[model samples]
Target: MLKEFRDFIAKGNVLDMAIGVVMASAFTSIVNSMVSDIIMPFVEAALGSTDFTSIVVKVAGITFRIGNFMQAVFTFLIISIVLFFVMKAVASLKNRFTHEEEEEEEEVDPTEALLTEIRDLLREEKQSASK
Candidate 1:
């Protein structure tokens, strides 16, 4: 069990996943800051001081903060857009740094290789015979 665990860690998939998780966590903080600090202020200004969360109608004495819901929706949208652009930039940089390696030659089947050799030998024999 110890050996199996060691092998699993050695495979590097876990390490890659850890790195990805860390990067995502860091990216999330940045997006959250942008949404709360940068974008939300503009949205608030556009929306004005009229608190949407307070404007509610009671159907069966049920209170619904529509303004709060709208705020949540806008926050989600801004975060999504910011993350999208960040991911796009990351992809562009990754593409720029990591070039597409030349494809390796496909492995010829052993039987096919043998048959090719036989065909070449027969062609040579036929050529010699014709001469």
Candidate 2:
């Protein structure tokens, strides 16, 4: 059981997933900061300095914070768009590196060639003997 656990932990996919989780967490923080600190200020400026997070509505004793919800929705949209472009750029870079214009030369396997030669020789011997 211990060996199995160790093998599972040592797998490449598990390590990659762990790294991805860490990177995504850091990316989330950067996106959150970009939305709240930079973008929201500009939006606020354009909207006459209205505090979107403070706008709320109360109905039948239930308080609804529509402004905060809108802010969150905008933040999510920005983050998703940023991530989409980032992923697209990364995919393009990866393709650029992995794609080659020059044609790759195909090499025949020596063992397979030898096996075919042996089979041909045996067939020739059998046909000659039959004749």
Q: List the pairs of residues colliding in candidate 1.
A: none
The deviation in Å at residue 64 for candidate 1 is: 3.4
Task: Provide the lDDT at 68 for model 2.
Answer: 95
Model number with the top lDDT: 2
Find the 10 residues in a row with the least total lDDT in model 1: 98-107
Off by over 4 Å in 2: 49-51, 100-131
RMSD to the native, candidate 1?
7.4
Query: Could you say which candidate leads in TM-score?
Result: 2
Task: Give all TM-scores, in the order shown.
Answer: 0.58, 0.62
- What do the candidate models score in CA lDDT, each in turn? 0.78, 0.82
Residues 16-55, candidate 1, lDDT per residue (tens digit)?
A: 9989999989977888888778877887798674245665
Tell me the lDDT of candidate 1: 0.78
Query: Model 2 — TM-score against the truth?
Result: 0.62
